[model samples]
Target: MSDTKSAVGYTRLSQTSDASIPDQKREIRNLADREGFALLNIYDDGQRSSGFDAERPEYLEMQAELETGEVDVLVVRDRDRLSRDKRERSMFYYDLDEWDVELWTTTDGRVEFTDDESWLIEMIRNYMDDVTKRREIQKAKKKVQERVDNGYWQGRPPFGFRLDSDKRYLEPDPGKFDTALTVLQMRENGATWSEIEDETGVSAGTISRILDNEERYLSHVE
Candidate 1:
């Protein structure tokens, strides 16, 4: 058997706007080659949000493989690529400790788990990553809110509305106006949200919003 250590690379791009996965993979592969590690495979979570509650199939697969003792080391472009959440990072570190697996990163080199100093450094890194991610999220939300306040619709248009010529303000969808009117009529006639949903094919929550914003819908009518 070869003396080379077996390793698997993990790459994650938290958002579509984030850096490309290929770049991360290339860096990890280069590190592995330079370190004389036999890169067994690469697990990529492309364009998947790394929110605490988000599910990452590729990360889970990598964890499963780690449990099998086949992978001696886990490679990532950086610690944040593994996780930015402190709780998640702690849990992953515990697993690595339990499995006797080493973690190597291109940015920080090999993560030394044997010393308190190393652990403290890793904790500080995780905290910094968390702060940076939270700030970015706040900035994004503020921008979205500002757009909405400026009468620019974000994401998809509502059921009975479509983007206007400039693709900013929402205008009533001509084809769906009748359906919207019918929904309003049904609600005013004492129809339950569920009943209206079944009859009109619009969701109950959306029906509620439509009814709540009834004046806006009616304003478009001649």
Candidate 2:
């Protein structure tokens, strides 16, 4: 972020989360100001996911621009803002070399990045990113189980019955719920799994799962 450096801020937001985008931009802007960097452009990919499997539109666009030698630095909120994948993380390492653009990141209120000893810095960054992503996944899985154990619906809310509600509780849809009940009844009535699946238009696997769900069967009885 030296005065000699010119930068562009690259930001991405998940498709459903624009609520915090303003704060993200503000954080980047403040950093640019404090660091005395002449910001070249603000490249924003709204409603885009930056996970490893997907390449964000604005991110790709910025890459094209960088390849043309447009930016000297790329700034973001954190390592995860770019990616959570170790392989995708390597893209940054190489891309910076190709474009001669330094990656600048601020996490926990401090600006960090590579320097003369950049490879060493990148190695540590790569390690920390992997650790962070692993812990995040584990935490998400545990939260799902915790919600299920607390008698709340677990995992992402399925279609129907207020899917967007913040609360974890399930409100069984009348149509699907009835189908669910019949599937369970058929199972207990000694119907073949495939027979129940055909009757309910539910996937055979889904039918088997609903039939096996102790909570759903108890509620079906109630």
Candidate 3:
């Protein structure tokens, strides 16, 4: 084991992360055992988004270890576990290259810095991850809009409103609706935004927006 490569595994699960972490770890372990790599440790970022600016504590720790030359190879369940953004994946790839650490994945296979085709394949894998995430996001947004059109709230209910018992539509809050209506009436009576804010305790910006979107708010009032 001492003469073999000191390898560390990294796994991340964002969307399907709950059921996939164990599976990822098992695959990495099996690979290490079969390939005779000296498995040093496994790092995981559970439920952490693979976004460009996400705070991945375990991933950062792994990078620090890589910098210190503790690991000769890095293993992951997939390239998306490292990053879904091309810029971030490229940055991580170069950093690992600088540290002379190889990358092994269950999905895209092993990548050594000296292997030119390996780098191209890794890039293609990361690019595909980004494309998949974008498509998922677009589909989610379309579904949300469809729900909104059907009079269902896509997210949390606004102030002075609550989600109905079925958790689909926004319903007027018995305690807060009167105040909201009074605020709206004041705005209708030529009250300034600041005046509405002072009377209703809602922010001036919010009050202005509520007044501006007449069809959305007034429809509820009627």
Candidate 4:
């Protein structure tokens, strides 16, 4: 119980850290020792920008340790002390929640699963995490809806159309688009989905597949 390798402490900053490693290190080591954690490692990134997505090697390394069960808990001053970006911070919290790793923040000291007050804390955490996820989903849905209204290609184009050099618009491929028109007219003529596929020399499956794609009808001229 007097050992010092049981948990890892991760500290970060979005811009530049006004805090120092020696300072944060002192606090974490003291906290862990007080709680009887062995104090595995203290991961720090002094001047790293959080703007670089997935570029924090130290953070990723800490996550790897968590995955391999190398630590009993992860301590931070607060979630923002981990990362200001919501997605990245949520990523760590989500993985910890799944792995059942004790997440502690001195801002709200000593969060633990066995604590009597944990249930209420956990309920609030769940609600907060849910709100974060819902906001992300709603943002994605809005982007897609906007794209559809503008007739911009939000997804890959059908076999006949290819994405433009900029990957923005879908441009008609002469062979594929003409063939598509043939298949479309055939469908309009009461030809079966399979028949149109066979007659057009485009696979019956491919023909049928294109018809089922929402972009075929929904993607518009922007």
Candidate 1 C-alpha error for residue 85, in Å: 1.0
lDDT of 4: 0.70
Q: Which 10-residue window in model 2 sums to the lowest lDDT?
A: 155-164
Residue-wise C-alpha lDDT for candidate 2, range 141-221, written one tens digit per residue: 898788788877655544223333657666666677677777767878999877876787889777656745747445535
Q: How much is 92 displaced in model 2, in angstroms?
A: 1.5
Q: Write the per-residue lDDT of candidate 3 for residues 46-140, one digit (tens) a residue.
A: 66555554468888888999999878889887767788788798889999999999888876678765777868876787788788888988898
Ranked by lDDT, top first: 1, 3, 4, 2
Candidate whose lDDT is highest: 1
Which residue segments of model 3 deviate by more than 4 Å?
Answer: 17-19, 115-117, 155-167, 170-222
For model 2 the local lDDT of residue 99 reads 75
TM-score of each: 0.70, 0.59, 0.65, 0.46
- How far is 34's C-alpha from truth in model 1 (Å)? 1.1
Q: Rate the local accuracy (lDDT) of all candidates.
A: 0.87, 0.69, 0.80, 0.70
| Clash-forming residue pairs, model 2 | none
The residue-by-residue lDDT of candidate 4 on 1-222, one tens digit each, is 444547889876554334655666777777787777877788876555352356687887888888887677888766556654455655666688777678877567766556547655655665575567467658979999997788777887777888888777878776877787777678878998768866888887777776776356335324
Which regions of candidate 4 deviate over 4 angstroms? 1-5, 112-222
The order of the candidates by TM-score, greatest first, is 1, 3, 2, 4
C-alpha positional error of residue 157 in candidate 4 after TM-score superposition, expressed in Å? 49
